[model samples]
Target: MNRILVIGGTGTVGRQVVSRLAATGARVRAMARNPGAARLPPQVEVVRGDLTLPETLDGCLDGIDAVFLVWTAPATAVAPALERITKHARRIVFLSAPLKTPHPLFQQPNPLRAMVEHIERLIETSGLQWTFLRPGMFAANALNWWAPQIRAGDVMRWPYLAAPTTPIDERDIAAVAVRALYEDGHDGAGYVLTGPQSLGQFEQVSAIGRVIGRSLRIEEISPDEAQRELLRIGPLVAVNMLLNAWAAAIGQPAHVTSTVAAITGAPAKTFLDWATDNAAEFRA
Candidate 1:
């Protein structure tokens, strides 16, 4: 029995990964600062650990064969955490963005991309088997960015209405991660995951509208206004990166890949599918 450790097991994709791994009857352990708050499967052994504090990772890695790592913190702790992981785990499957892809969507250099690239370099030289899962925009962003406005009324205001993206479902991303964690031949491979079709931000909202039985309208706003609103909610660097990526992606089709089906033996879910599944979020 292989002991698998999942960092950020309580998060979006990480939670699904933990569930999938547990369903396979694998010995799964989840590391979180607050293990008590993590609503994981009864079989999973929840352990208290913080990635920022390298000393807390000491016992968590003890007997783990492979790790599903989701870097949820700053880049400052990445090096030390990687050092600890390399010393223990034989393999690691990392959840990262598609920074190396030449598509306009990923071409914009950001702090997150820089941090991931640095971690990738460290993992490469660590002599450990590593698989990188680089996924594009998440379909769940609709819930975060537009759900509030959708629930309040039939009109949603946002920037980059023409900016296209293949919003990959978090479940699909998790399935691929699970395969890379347990299977062979994925070592040193970087997988670029995306949704099945390219849809613009307006089309995305329309999909949500159809799912919720509403005639929704999208009002495009200025990028500068979007930046200011985003800055109020998130860091300036992340907001700028998003603004730049959307600006670059305008009038261009999003980069779609068959890597999900190639690896997981299933087609990637479309944005409409995601919208339909999460329709309740858009409903009052």
Candidate 2:
């Protein structure tokens, strides 16, 4: 059995990866900044590790054969962390954004993209077998974007409601990542993963409303208003990035891919599937 370490194992996608790996009867170790707070299964060994503090990763990487890296640390810490990971893990699967894709949606200025590219270069030259999972818009973003609005009422006020996106489910990303981590032939491969359908922002909201049995109202606001209101939820850069991406996506169809089905032998979950699975979050 491969002893796998999942860095950033407490995040939305990372948590799914950890659970999926554990279900496969693999020796799974989860690295978190706070081990006691990690609400994982009893079988998973949780270790305290912080990417900002590279010294903390030494213990977490011990005897770890393969690693699933979800980097949330600053770009300054990438070099030191990769050095430590390379010493222990022979293979690594990094959760990254679609930086290489030529689509305007992905080409928009994102602060995270520079950091990911830098990390990718380091991993490529580090001599460890590496695979990059570049995922598009996450379907789970609805939780943060509209769950509160839905939980309170039916009106979802937003900007660029006509913008199209694939809204890939995070589980599909994890499933592809799991195969890359333990399996062969995935080394040096970069998988561009997305949901199967190209649905507009309003259509996605309608899908959620249909799944939850509600006739929700989607009020389109200007980008300026959205920036102002969304700032309360995320950082300035993240808010601007989303607004910019959605604004650019309005006149074009979102880039969709079949990599999930190609790799996992099953189609990626639709936005409706995601909404149905998490309908409770939108309930009052």
Candidate 3:
């Protein structure tokens, strides 16, 4: 693809995708509601657009050969947005969750998954060459959910400490996505991406502690307590979905995949690596 548009380009994975694509000298445009604050690479064209407003996307897709779509809003506008996208872009690479993956981690029925399934169906019939990057739990979530606790004390209190997950690095996810956007033979593909190894929540916490030179403790709490805490911080439906998924994944290791290595020609990064890279977030 010669020219690419990155929806949600200001986001974690989308920013990295923009950087990678721009590095290769592709004409890149990042669609954001506030282009002034997107702070993308100087070479990346930041366009004012909102996915919730389908009419705003009309000009954003112009002259774009491919699109790196990271759906951030609800699915209400997906059909209209896809209609606009297919009109201009020849290909699309979506950052999506592993909805069809049979692992317990993904098997749970959740509103997020339902929305993703609906979007996937629309993309399938949109006639644009498409690729779905179905990533598992993101390692970056540690910063959002646990950084405050780790920065404050030695004890990491959480629920379902035994739940195993292969947390893929956002950078790795972006690397694979860049390939799918510009490379051939990736259309009509759904790639399940994960980190190199399956690590329990306790183990992941320990990994962070090791990087920061602290011996942290994991205090498992009741699911109800966890639910109450999550309710205070996030939506109830999402909180419950996570609680149920973790409960189901207590003994089951997350499904690991070689797709990242297959596409990027490098082994998937480890949790230790992710912790070390983001060690400052966990430092006391």
RMSD of each: 1.1, 0.9, 1.2
Candidate that beats the other on TM-score, 1 or 2, i.e. the better one: 2
> What TM-score goes with each of the models?
0.97, 0.98, 0.97
**Which candidate number has the best lDDT?**
2
Please report the candidate that would top TM-score against the real structure.
2
For candidate 1, write residues 89-160 as lDDT tens digits. 999999988988998889987788888899899998999999999999998877778888889998788899
Clashing pairs in 2: none
Ranking by lDDT: 2, 1, 3
Worst 10 residues of 3 by lDDT: 227-236
Q: Rate the local accuracy (lDDT) of all candidates.
A: 0.90, 0.92, 0.90
Clashes of each: 0, 0, 0
lDDT per residue as tens, model 3, 37-107: 99998988999998889989989998889999999697788888888999998899999899888888788
